[model samples]
Target chain A: MPVRLYLSHVGKSFTMHLQGGTTIPVVSGVDFSVGEGECVVLGGPSGAGKSSILKMIYGNYRCDQGQILVTVGDEIVNVADSEPRKILQLRKDVIGYVSQFLRVIPRVPAVEVVAEPLILQGADEGKALARARDLLTRLNVPERLWGLPPATFSGGEQQRVNIARGFIAHYPLLLLDEPTASLDAANRAVVVELVAEKKQDGVAMVGILHDQDVRDRISDRIVDVTAFRAEAA
Target chain B: MTDFFSDDPLLQVNGVTRYYGDRIGCRNVSFQLWPGEVLAIVGESGSGKTTLLNCLSTRLAPTAGAIEYRMRDGAMRNLYQLGEAERRLLMRTDWGFVHQNAADGLRMTVSAGANVGERLMAVGDRHYGHIRETATDWLGRVEIEADRIDDDPRSFSGGMRQRLQIARNLVTHPRLVFMDEPTGGLDVSVQARLLDLLRRLVADLGLSVVIVTHDLAVARLLSHRIMVMRHGEVIETGLTDQVLDDPREPYTQLLVSSILQV
Candidate 1:
């Protein structure tokens, strides 16, 4: 299988400039590679730096050291050191991230939110909306809520809307951060089926699934993050 | 990734700085606006977002820095270096500025039809019949009734007047539009409708716009990228969602959080 994403010796930490410049180390020497059509789960307890690794891969957080290389067509770009513009371009064309919460844009319909990514990629408006409607239906979002903004939806409803939006567009490498955290059994099963479809399409996925059943079913390999724990000085 | 329709920016501002007698109005601001893209300048009042917008539109000159615009002839010219007559011609033909106060942008003494037709006249359209026909078409496009075309803007309500201002500006098919709080004075429901109309027209016309607004919601709905200003300097700039969702700067984070949630 072709490797879609690779990270080696990756490290990250936070500095409290207000608190006398104290450096708090988070993770170090994190090494992993996810191949096409494979779903790799980051397994560990809380505070094990799983989310940070995902953010680094998505170029949301700047990694302190080593490489976070993403395969884009024939080019390999390092997210850790690339310019902000390059990372933004990579995000639009290569990576897709589904964060835990949905950042709602006011007055935009829920269906438009899901259809926006496809539209930004130059898909026809009618076809994008059709696909968005299809995903929203599959995820069991109430039909009445599709035309309204997701801001007022309950936590679980919002999560499903976020999932529908995330899964609407096809990305070669998708990063999932607690995507199913608020979903119930039926919707969680839908997500699992969605993951299977992505794998069949040869997408490489890295996710943090705390739900053991879902994790066990989808993960081809588990990269335990405890080994990458950074020691305090 | 490769745009076949000319990757060159439509407007470029390099280190633009303005001073109001030693106190900075805006300082060292720089960014590029591509064709068919909307860039929002967002900050609290006194943050110099207005100053930057004025400088970009040539309504106000900067103390330092250059503002270059790509003309319809495909030549880049420094706005400050252009002659007064040429600048006026560009303002009437290629550029449009929508003020926060509708009265400021419109002629209260003239009928809404005349308000929209005046720009056509400025650009050398001589046929009165064709100009009035186009004016009526634009009034309808902005959701104002065609019957309202003959009424003066002073007789219209605030929202109607604002919509008329937009029609007047857009009637010329300007490539770039500068909006300063275009939805500022309207009611919530009215603002939503106007924003919907503006979004459609912007997309349909493929306009490049630089809009200054204190409302983050307006910024999110209209802009592709956002530049957050603080004390006359750009504090942080990024993709609109990235800046709003995961702001890196503490000030930006506070601004995003301060938005009233329902």
Candidate 2:
């Protein structure tokens, strides 16, 4: 197995216009790599830029310096430099992100939110929805709520939906930012099992997590975002 | 739960029917809502989810059946039992709304603080200093900076504007809130933060909410129960996890499958 996602000397800074255009640097000169079937955990205190690094990898935030590269099959793409269409295509197939919350189209059912990806990839809608149900069930989302929209769901329930949506697609690379932040201990265990299964399937993952147990269970290596935090400071 | 009126539902909707000219808006819709509960309505466009919501909110008159709501005084009365003026006042005092567009829910010309304080004012708060202080506190809770208090919502970003709108509607501490795709158009990052905030506020306040959205994730995070509608009728209704995990209905199965994953 080779490196699926690579980062070297990554840096990011925020221009706070409110603070009289003060440029506040957060991450600087961070380096890491995630290989096939490997899980690299970014562990550190809050505000240490663990999420910023993950954001840079997912192309949500731009890195000021260094390479944030991802290998989609054999082609290596710099997430920071990719075009919008290229990033979207990569997002659709290669790289997946499970952020803290579940963002979705209103009035859609829980099953459709999870199953829609497969349907777009040409899978039968019925089959896709059924598979979505399987994931939701495994994650412990209520059976009755499948038909309802999720706007009224609990924080923990919402996070499960985000997890289901992220895991529904088979990607070469995955990013998890406190994926279990809102989950209780019981649900957290389910996510741990899911991550293990994903690892066995050869999907490489990089996650920013504070839960020491989950981090210990999933990490093949630990990248201390504190290292970058120190540099930025 | 008290055995006396223990089964007394907070809202009892029976055989409600709504029509749009010759078109059926929704037919024979019936459900019960409890205190401190959230209910989500889900369906594709023209599936009658919107029509069903309109009827429940009394935005549209139902052609048949009855909708009963339990007032704060614990009296169950038919919706039309009250005068038109009383119904309008009840909507203002007891219910809150968060629309798909922040502009629709907020006074864009007003300051962010004023937008939140207006709800308090509506309920008869006259102390200018107290209202301002409370407004500032809510702004902080919603992750809005104090500096933005004097700024108008029209100049704010989409996420900020939406947050301001939520603060406004919540100021009066309404028991029931009606939201139509509250996080529909925001970016994923923004939407996540908003959902977390909403969950906290709802729990802290013990609010009952009737929300209509197409997104299953929102329902799962915020509601205890869910109702699935298709073509103006509820095809399935159950506990959030149960319905999503083990859908018994065919239409529900398609809906579960219809979600587009990121």
Candidate 3:
């Protein structure tokens, strides 16, 4: 039950030049948190700044005002004012992000995609390959297709490879952008179960989702971003 | 397998068998999709739902089967028999496909409007203004804000990109729209809204659709009939209500029961 992340009064804005030259408020005074091993589901209408919040959490975009305090273990790091390099380091070693669009490495087999993070993190090549293979096997990305590049795989198979990549590293904080959007029923269930299983290992997850049924199956805490947007307006 | 017929079968899969060196993808998979009807193909990841769609779209050649399409001039055509030029023509004019990932169906670097209007340009509609208007109309039909049409699809949220992809396909108003997990990447509220938009658009346009999804909830919401596949084969095919409510097969029962409603 330890605190893993905390964002207080986060405000992001943009300066828009009108006929009279004025500024517009895009997001104002948003706040939420995730604890160690807890999942916070963020849902809202399109353009409600759902992805923006993820960007803020991952330190991609800077907040104009307020503080974002992220707890890595016991120490609380103030991300609002932290240097970009510091944040980058934090993400590389501790944060695992799965974008909605799969970023495939051309000419690399599906199994190698999952192992890339591990290889980057300095894990032994053989060991990393072994773990990646196990993860793909568990997620049901067929063994025969492991050698084939993800470019040839179907939408669901590509997504499975992406999931394997995100979870293979086993970072404490996993930020997923619609991880199971294209999967068939069986693959979707496997993803839900996989996340639920990982939660037992004390990983904190924040994901943007459109599937309420899938959300209910895995989430313990749901943060409705639409409500936040309405309040801001 | 039981036999059935539709008034105008745009997609006719007869004795379709696909295998990868003896690992079965699907066997004797047969179905008929008529005009204006939404037939859903439901299965898990390995169930071969996508394989069937790929074979029909001619993205992948079936090992042993024939995919026949009834053309506009009261003539039946075999899609596989066509050469590269003819196949490309079918993709441009006769068929539309919306992949689960919006990026798959769309060019991320281009504006949303261009992504929707590419098919138009491919078929020789070079008027920029007309293409823009049509793109805007389809975007509005899918409930995306018209103002964002000029923005690169790379900047759009997942749900918005998906809507744009649907708009991109439907702007051509093709006879058959094959959707693979159209709402798979969205959250529940987003999914509900997207499903509502799809239902309204499908009803209004009478667009024939074949959707592949793992979500039975989606099947119940949008499909007129459902086809359940397991391990690359169709196990059950019936009306959505009948199959979902009273599945005759054990695998179907498991899939139905596993749905955790929010």
Tens digits of per-residue lDDT for model 3 on B53-123? 88878888889989888877868889888789988887888778988888888999989888889988988
* Per-residue C-alpha lDDT of model 2 across residues A1-233, encoded as one tens digit per residue: 79898898888876543445556779888888889999999878888888778877876665678998888777889877764335546776788888778765556678888887676455788888888999999999999988887878887787798789888878889998889886788889988998998999899999988888888888899887777774434
Give the TM-score of chain B in candidate 3. Answer: 0.94
lDDT of 1: 0.89
- Candidate 3 segments exceeding 4 Å error: A1-233, B1-6
lDDT of 1 by residue, B110-185 (tens): 9999999999999889999999999999999998898888889889999999999999999989999999999998
Ranking by TM-score: 1, 2, 3
TM-score of each: 0.87, 0.54, 0.52
DockQ leaderboard ranking: 1, 2, 3
TM-score, prediction 3: 0.52
What is the per-residue lDDT of model 2 for residues B1-85, given as tens digits with 9 covering 90 to 100? 1111145677799999988888988999988876677788887878887777777778888999999988889888898677898
**For model 1, what is the alpha-carbon lDDT of residue B72?**
94
- Candidate 1 docking category? acceptable
lDDT by residue (A1-233, candidate 3, tens digit) is 88777778887754332213334455667788898889998877878878777776776555667888877766778867765334544665677888646655345678877897887566899999999999898889889999987877887778888888888886788887888786778878888887887799888889887787888888888887765552323
* Chain A vs. native, model 3, TM-score: 0.87
lDDT of 3 at B148: 90
Q: What is the DockQ of candidate 2?
A: 0.02
- Please give the distance, in angstroms, between residue A142's alpha carbon in candidate 2 and its true position after superposition: 31
